[model samples]
Target: MPASKGSRNAVSSAVQQIVLSPSDADYLDQLIPAIKDAAHSNRTAQLLQGLSQFADNHESEIEGVCNTNHQEFVNSVNQLLQVREGTVRLTSEILDLNQSIQASTEKLAEHKKALVDSRSVRQNIDEAAQALEDCLEVLRLTNHVHDLLATKNHYAALRALDELQNVHLREVPQYKIAEMIQKSVPAIQKLIAEAVMTDLKTWLFRIRETSQFLGEVAFYHTELRRTRQKERAEKDPFFRNFKLNSAMDLVSDETDEFDVLDNDEVQVDFSPLFECLHIHEALGESEKFRAEYAATRRQQKDLLLPTSIRLVGDDEGGSLSALLESIAGFAIVERATMKKAFNLRSTVDVDELWDSMCQSAINLITQSLPDIDDADALLKIKGVIALFIQTMENWGYSVAALDSFLLTLFDKYAELLKQKFSRDFLEIVSADDYMPMPIQTSEEYEKVVNVSWYTPEKEQSDISFPCVLPFSQMYPLCCIDIRNFLNQFYFFSDDHFQHPSVIDETLKKSLDELLAQKVCRLLVDRLSSQYLGQIVQILINLEHFETACVELEQLLLAARSPASAGKSVALNATEEFRSNKKTAEKRIFELVNSKIDDLIETAEYDWMAPAAQTEPSNYIQTLTRYLSNIMSSVLLGLPTEIKELIYFDALSHAATMILALPLSADVPTINRNGVAALALDVQHLSQFVDSLGVPILRENLDELQQTVNLLQSDNSDEYYDVSTRNKKYGRVDPMNGPLLLEKLTQGMQSSGRTDKYTTLSSRFGKK
Candidate 1:
């Protein structure tokens, strides 16, 4: 069949398109499949066209597969041939080796069996040697335990037994070694316990010996005598008539003396108990020893005093005193021993010991307070507390526990004393006195004053003075009572009046405040029942108020710390009284100044009055006398500034009067000379006003001198000018006018000329 031209052309174009564009070739590839189907059904010549289009679409893919697959197949066939040849040669060698292995199989099996048999024998030998070594170690430990027991070293024997217990002997069940160890442990522990018991007995015997030695010391003889004498004095009615020294007495002021005792030559030996206590601690049986020691002390005390009545019975007094002395000696020695152990045992708890000691002391004091018949029991308790504190210091502890306990005890005891004895003290201080009552005058200007004996009084009877005891005696007694209260537990001596180191600073301040409150109470009770003026008068009878201040200051210095002495509330109150009087003086100056012009205008005669007139009309003299009271007892011992201000105030008043005097018609020279004299008196007073002191006072003095000079000047009109341009224009305004500078500055400011005077001084150049 010949192809049509159109079909041939289509085939050529399709081929070109497929070659130019692969996407178009993909489209032709799809169309070629369908075209082939159509050509196969319709025209076979078109199949060739479809075939050519399909070939064009997949030409590169077909060439790549042919090229890659052909080379890969050829290389794989060559490798397979080589591998097949090697396998044939290896098969021949493997068959030959198999024949050789089959020939030697029986010999190799015998060699393996021989090696296994030798390894088993070596393992057995090692097991036997280890067993033998373990058996020897067990036997050695057993022998060591036996040896230690024979030597009576119980602790070492116990340690050996403990070591043997660690052995894990798991031999045959019939073996007796483990059973024997289990059975021997109880017997060994028993032996060690018996040995410890025997050691404890030996130490106890030594402690008894040490206590006996302490009991034989000579220091107790003086203590016994003192106790007996105190007992007798308390019982005797004649002794009761006189006041006994308090339990806390340092010394008696009435005696103005103190007795001294020589140092004792004998001392107790405490070393044996010290050693015993250490041994007990090491044995872990300190509590047991302490219990036993307390029992022994009780037994000895019971044997010494069989009955309670024997304590005071004269027939058995000597025995009772000896028992007390013995008990005291035992306590001291025991404390010393405990102190030694406390110092040595750094790990021992000190709080426990301190609590025990403090509780015991507190119990003793609390139980003994109700039965305080004499100083004997109190003295014993005091000695115990002091010795305990001393031991704490010796043992190198803080000792704050014992100190705090004593403070608590002292507070209760002081309260007891205050309740029982304060009333009697008050009774003694409330005695009646003959001090006259102050009289008030009808005149408004007169200060209230005491009546003169020369005047015939409408009421002849005198008002009773409020206080009974003089402060001179009262202060000393109060101090004594305070000393007795404070020293009971504090151990203050005559030579050492300072607070003991055992009392903290805060506690000391508390005690001082308490005493101050008591003394102030006494002062209030005695002095407050009267008028203030009368109280001052009463104080005047006893001593000068300044003297009282001095005495109080001294008492405070002796009683407490110097830092607090001056600042005490009581002393500050006294200072407040002085301050109040100073304020009153200032108010009185103001009062006198208010009436100065009126007093000057009404005077009929010369300002100076005759000396014979006890009550004068001269207001200046009255003011002078009133002010003199400020320098006298009212403000005595006050600060110097106060006094300076007082004098300056008087100077200012006199200067004001001199400057404010109007031009009077009658007795012009009299008025001028009188004012001049007043100014001269103020100038004389300026000598006492300390020119180099406070600036305000010095300035006042300078003002007063200028006023005095002007009043006495020949040309007074020159200074009287008020013009701003005048040379003498700056004088203080006369007749209560405003200051000259104030006047001139105000006038200039009103005229809007303030800047005119800004440089006035530089322009004028002092005129």
Candidate 2:
């Protein structure tokens, strides 16, 4: 196989030489193995082996190039060593140069230190020299300022001293100069204070010498501002800050020596000057105002007093209404003037002026009251004072003084009234023609007892009762006076007079006492005598006694009632008047009762006449008629209980008269049935009066019934029989038990048939 491969290789080589020839012998030898290897079945391994041989050749060429490079690296190392040698030399040269520079720097610093020390020494010398010069200047200025102050050139001295202080050389020299200024300040201050004082005094003198009232000072000060504005019209007037104590300009110069040194501006107080500057002109003006006000008050008083009184009474005498109107008008003017003069115009703070003025007003009214002396002047005076008091109260001032004066006036007026009314009462009492008794005839008596007075069968004359004075005439005058008093002092009638704190109750008591003691007593004393007896007889005859009682009661009550009742004296006066009333009432009742008893005792019945005459016995009819007249007239306005008691007494007396007188010959003969019938009429009359619903009337009615019942049961002299037990028990008759029950039954039955309240029987228990 090798021989064939080698022949192939040679052939291929010859071909290859023609295609790609190999130049070396080894190359050919190597190519032949590669050809053989390629021709073999294992050509890959052969190709690899050829590549490895090529790599080895390449590695050999690389190693040869690396050797040439190693020689160049040696040359470079040598050059670097040469450069290192140059750097070392240069570093040495630099270090030697650094050492030389360091030596020079030390030398420069030493020179700078020396120069700085020399400069510091020169600055020190210059500062020391300037300070010495400043000290010299301070001493010179101090001496100069002291000299200026010695000459009292305060403004110049102050300037120089300020300049000295500004130097501030040393505290000692400055303090020494301040001491000199301090010592000189007192004299400088005195001169400046004198100048300021002169200016202030000039201003004050100008103000005080102004010819004006002190009250015009505020206005004058206003004028000062106007004058200043006009005087400096060309310039804007500097409005000074109006501090209350803006006198600082004057005060600052008036300083003590120590005060000057302690502060730049010494403070001085000018309050003493203000206090010393008192205006005597104000005192004079006040006195003048007082005199003027006093004169004005005098003129007002004159016009108010007699002029007011003249207005009250005309030349003939003014009417009450006109007098009051004038007094009130005067009071109004006085009040207004007093307030305006005292409160507004007068400068006096003293109350004496006002007090006197108030007193004058009161005095004017009081004095005017007594100035009236006419017959009716007293009444007019009272009216005037009342109007004056009312007017003053309406004016709303202090009324204590006026009220006090009024009390005295009222007392005096009351005393005067006592005299006037007493004299008037006495004059009328002595006059016989005032009230005369009328003559009463049998026909008049017959008419009175017949109960037919509305149309009397017999014509009767005018029947007049005797009176101390006709109440119709005199009493109206009293009413007029009372009405006048009340209307005049209307304020007193209000709630104000009731409280003792407001009005003097003692004065009220005295006034009431005067009326009770004088006026009321006059009426009572005059009315309670024979004249009263005559009046009572006439009233009883005409059955008007109850009317008299009520009139007297009203009069007594008015006398007892006073304006104020809180005082003990007023209470005592009321008690006295009440006692007088009771006495008068008792006397009046006694007189009327005596007359009634006489009529009852004299009553007689003419039973022997015809049946018509017997039907109403002359005695019984007369009694009943009289009683009817009595009830109709006297019991007109009496209280129900009083009327019942009166009627009971009249009926009881009639029963007593009938029971006491038997059916004897002295009386006209009458049958037992007639007596029984009379008894029935008596019972009926008793029942009629008993219907007034007074519990007391029931007992009297029951007694009357029993008396009539006995007269009917026993037609004998025992008609008024009193059982021993009943008499001892104060019961005069047996009770008419069945009769009363029968009457009550009839009353009830009749009441059911009639209106309950309107029925007579119903009036019994319902009332």
Candidate 3:
């Protein structure tokens, strides 16, 4: 009735390992009985008929039970199947992993075998290297032996050399070459000795450094020394405070220490590492001495470097410098201590230097002389002066160094200019090189003039020489100062001789005059032989431009007086009341007219008229309208608002004469005073004062003042003087019979007075 040992073992194992909850225990309790009963019933189905019958009698119950048990079994079987499927997959994967492990194990074994084979091969190579090294040693020994044999048995030594050559280590070395070089140049041996000494010094320095390092390490290993050093490093704020800084800060400032762990102290470099630098510095000092030795060898080798000088027999800075040194010695004794530094080649003769310089300067001066029309030469001279200044700068010479030369040159040029401009003017020239000169300005000039003649070298005066050169204005006039050769030729030209001036006087006059003379063919040009037009103009000024009447009276007075000069008269009928030059006339006339208009009160209209007229004499103002007509005539061919007036008979006759004469001739005209003179002539006229009837000179007038108011009278004769007196229009008795007769006869008796002397012809006339 107790469980078997195996079963008990299995149950214990299941409890520990199988992991079933209480629910699984319940399921198994129901499942186990159903399984057993089914097995038993199937086994005894024929034998237990009665039992079977009983079972059949409760078949429904049994069937229900079977159904419940079967369902429970099916559920249990499905869960078991899923668990089995998972176990199968896991087992298959384990089998595959085991196979992979076996294959990897085989490969690892093969690699281990290969590694062993490689190690063996490497060992063989190491043995072979040793053999090769031994062979090289033998060859080196044989070479040494061969070298000894070379002197005694040369042929045998050659045979030994052939054997040595077949080996790997018989190649040439620098030591042998150095030995050969030493035989030729003993200095090479000295160089080798020095190199060996340097290597020895390196080993000695290394030993000293190792001893010092060991001593330092020993001191640090001891507790007391270590504590002291650590204390000192801590106590010194500079090293003690040293701590981690950011990498960025260390990069920005080299002194920043990210980890200042380096144990080296700030002290002079010592031993092998620093000894190498010291050796290099020592060698550098000897390089100058070696260069001299090299120069000597270079002579034997016949080598040349850049910047070398060539000589006839030899070419060397050293040899040439040596020769100069010898010459300096000789010169010192013969010529009293040399004025310059020694050892310079005599490419140029010292004795001839001044002469050469002076001659070159003279040639330059001559070459720089300006031609009649040499622009390029002038540019070249300017370039030379620039070159001189640049040369002075390059030499760093004193201003006084150039002052004397400049003064001499300027004086010579001044003398040349004096000769050049002896008979003409000096033209001031300009240069494109307009930079301010270093030479004295006016202030400096005054300073120089005030300075003592014998000033110290440092205080030498800068004397400014006033210079002359050519100038070109926007326009060239005869007044322009003459230039060189062109001016020389001009001064001797025929026109120049006529004027006895150095320039073309005519060219200086004006383009207006030149053009007018050429165009008008006026009397200004007629004076090629002499000046008749100018004389005539002068005489006209003296005559003061009289009116025809005044001029006539003048001619008459001359005719009448024995004192009146005949030399000035030309019975011109000239009636030259015309203007002289147009500009002269226009300017003077405009100015005079402007002045008169400013003074006159009655000038409501323009002082001149728009057309030619010969009416409105001044007597019309006082006597007649003739003066206005004459003035208007004189202003003919003038500007706008200018005119001349004449009556129909006189104008028609004048027009005919104008047409008759050549169109070129300036027509005659009257003047202002002539009108006055004519009025005077009428009143107190020498030619025309009436003494008896039909005895005076002939005259006529077109217009008169309407003072009488005549048309108002019914009978002109009855209302004349008596009616005027009755009206009492004026102080005079105008209507008396005799007065009336006198008035009526006045119109007839005075030939100059018009018929309508008192007639009212105007729209606003009093009549």
- Between prediction 1 and prediction 2, the one with superior lDDT is 1
Candidate 3, which ten residues in sequence have the lowest lDDT sum? Answer: 468-477
TM-score of 2: 0.32
Per-residue lDDT of candidate 2, residues 383-458 (tens digit):
4444444333434434576557656654555455556555654554344232322324655444333421123223
Model 2 residue 596 CA deviation in Å = 3.1
lDDT of 1 by residue, 1-767 (tens): 67778766666564455445557457556445434433334533354455445554444444455477866545544554464454345334433433344445445667778778877887888876766666666667767777876775556665676666655344522347666756766675566555645555565455444443344342343334334445655777454322223332213223333111112533444444554555455556678766665555445434433233222223323433343334344444445555555643222333444344345445544554564433334344444444434423433445575566555544444444454445544543454232332333332112121211112223323423231222233433444454454554344322122244333233344434433344344444455342333343334322323333445455545655444444443454345335444444445455445544455454343432222122233554544454455456443433466556655676567555644442233322322334445454555445444533446755554554565555445444455355731444344445422232222333344445556333442343522
Best by lDDT: 1
lDDT of each: 0.45, 0.43, 0.32
**Stretches of candidate 1 above 4 Å error?**
1-199, 202-358, 363-380, 395-398, 413-421, 432-546, 558-767
- Give the TM-scores of the predictions, in the order they appear: 0.31, 0.32, 0.17
Error of 3 at 188 (Å): 30
The true-versus-predicted C-alpha distance at residue 308 of model 1, in Å, is 15
Clashes of 2: 3
Write out the backbone clash pairs for model 1.
Answer: 431-468
lDDT (C-alpha) at residue 20 in model 2: 46
Per-residue C-alpha lDDT of model 3 across residues 453-479, encoded as one tens digit per residue? 112123334433452111111002112
lDDT of 3 at 188: 27
